[model samples]
Target: MLKKIDRAAAFIQKESELFRCPMCHQQLTAKEKSLVCSNGHRFDLSKKGTPYFLKHQVQTDYNQAMFQHRRKLIMNGMYQPLIDVLTPYCEGERILDVGCGEGSFLSQLATSAQLKPSVGFDISKEGIYLASDYGENLFWCVADLTNLPFQMGSFTRVLNIFSPSNYQEFKRVLVPGGKVIKVVPGSEYLKELRQAFYPEDETKQHYSNEAVIDKFQETFTKITRKTLKYTFDIPENCRLSLLEMSPLEWGVSPENKAQVQKNPLKQITIDLEILIGEFL
Candidate 1:
């Protein structure tokens, strides 16, 4: 009763072209209250408020805690500037978000613009599952990027922010005239944390430079580059979640954690370099 209606609503909301099957990369047609593919594959939308794009199984390295912190930080506007730089490329057409953790950026893009349709894919099931609350217009999938489960030339714009990029797969799925927006850390990203954790006065801690990104740009047109930086005060309540979301998780010693807990950071730097390129 209620389950059927929820599925129906989800199906109708995903009426756009983003709900293609992850395995077959076929546009799904909602038939008899279930989503079906041309080759006879089918997946029923879950009443738990998520669309089951993968029927079988997919493994992921992410856990609920990682996304939980990321969600809060993003929603708090930690990465707003990066999203602003990438939004212009959308222009009301198809867009694909690779490794879209918790779908915060995608959700903001959908609400802020008159977007045509957008789909978000991640290797993390928990990430996608948590993303369902954003909107029905946004299609969420749990899948891998090394071998993207999408058809060729499916998207007009692709966005990869602070995530692993599969260049070959990204170029394959994007339309010939499409563009890609990638965000990486600037030379000063998280300098404060690194200083506190490592205390290595000899080693210069910094971010990726143009030379480091040269291999990435060989296949695309280098459009523009911009650096963004801001200071954020870490509240005592959310400090633990913030620590878990960082690479410092492994590098931090038990003693270091104790230090952080005792003298929690008042402010930290969020520095990033945004690169916008056109597919060649």
Candidate 2:
């Protein structure tokens, strides 16, 4: 088996031209165990097989335990409906998944769609650490969305799934006519969980996509929106794992958590809207 550093070095050597120095915007080249740029900015690949791209350390509420359950849920086909909708548009030479937590969606998409040179990055190091254990062919990195460490027009398809959007950076790194497959939570997404946690909070009972869609319109042309709504029957034993996977439950009271654990949900809604955007 190739050592972790060896695998990382190979990936960097193959795709180094696609990356840029976040500090100086210069092309990066793979050196001994590091990606270095003309400006002397160097990024070292971690022992876990992910490169550090963020300028500063960021603390996140997302932890390994949470991501582990997320991987299980995704692998078991919780988001299969969404994947089906996204498969057709996944055609491209290079694909990028922004804010790819644990790389579950991107890894599945790459494998199912038979895509090569698939790359995924997240601001959370914990998430990227888990993601590095995914396919060896895919490149995983801990990177900030606002300041992507890539060259202009680098990707043919950019995926933004239930993650924050950085339109400017996205557009900068997308080829002309490249597609941005953005997934946003629909109004009914996780309604059961919301109701369980915030039963009396009227505002928390519903969601709105109008604002998010409107913002997309401002930056992208030929925008198309598709709604994917489904109900996933939760196995009695997996209900707790589902609850733990969601960041929404992070701030809930311990009593509320126990309540959800006790009265397991039979089915959970997976309502989402996928927006396909092309640059003008």
Candidate 3:
């Protein structure tokens, strides 16, 4: 495991010149088991083969159980259509996934795009640990999105899939002419689940992408939007996994959850808008 981590570290050090200290913004030098900056900010590689890049600890509701179910769903081809839409933009040699949960999407994208030196990071330590354990030939790290520990213009492609956007940070890390592929949920995405949880709430039945789309356009010069809408049949046994993977059920009552579990939808809709953009 240590040897594999060393290889991942070496790959990061060699492929991009953008890795920098989160604190001092100095260039990071990779050692056998850690990365160090000129000002002496050091981040150690964990036993799971992921690096620690966050300055402080973060608490998140995205726990291991959620990620595990998410991985299972993803592996079962739940997001293959989205992956097909995302593969083209991942043309460059280096790719970075911001807010990558468990690294499943990034790993699949890397394989589909035939990319090298793909890296992903999240604020959740458990997610990163799982990512490192399950993903192959990818660099995983626990890092903050706003304070990314990479040098300016270091990546050729940046992926933001169902994750929050930090436009300034994204633009800073992407090379000139590089692309950002962002996926945002559209109306009807998981509508069945939403409806199941909040049957009487009219607002819960619909979703809007106006604000997020407008913001993406405001940030990027050239933008293209593609909406992939489809319905997927949910396997009987995987229904619980599907329910557990979503944040929508986080605050629902146990009775409501049980209600959905007992009468699971046979098919669910996947409505997602993929935005491809380049810096102005």
Evaluated with lDDT, which candidate comes out highest? 2
TM-score per model over all chains: 0.83, 0.96, 0.95
Backbone clash tally (model 1)? 0
| Tens digits of lDDT, candidate 1, 1-280 | 3443464455444563434566677776766456667888776555544455554577655777888887887787767776676667666867788988888988888866667667787877788878776664566666677766566787888888878888788888888878887878777777877777766642645545676467556867857777788887766566655666756566677887778767767777888877778766
Per-residue lDDT over 1-280 for candidate 3, one digit per residue giving the tens place of the 0 to 100 score? 4466666666666643657889899988876677888888888777676778877778999999999999988888889998888777775468888888988888887788888777899999988888886445578889888899988888888888889999999989988998898899998899988989888778877879889989998989789899999988887677789889978978778988899888877888999989989989
| Superior by TM-score: candidate 1 or candidate 2 | 2
- By lDDT rank, best first, the candidates go 2, 3, 1
TM-score, candidate number 3: 0.95
Question: By how many angstroms RMSD does model 3 differ from the true structure?
Answer: 1.7
For residues 1-280, what per-residue lDDT tens digits would candidate 2 score against the true structure?
Answer: 8877678788888888789999999999999779999989999989977889988899998898999988888887889888888888885458999989999998877877878687899988989989988766788899988899999998899999989998889989998898899999999998999999878776877869889888887878889988889999876667778888978887778888799888878899998988998977
Ten contiguous residues minimizing lDDT sum, candidate 3: 9-18
Worst 10 residues of 1 by lDDT: 1-10
User: Model 3 residue 90 lDDT?
Assistant: 76
Which of the numbered candidates is closest to the native, going by highest TM-score? Answer: 2
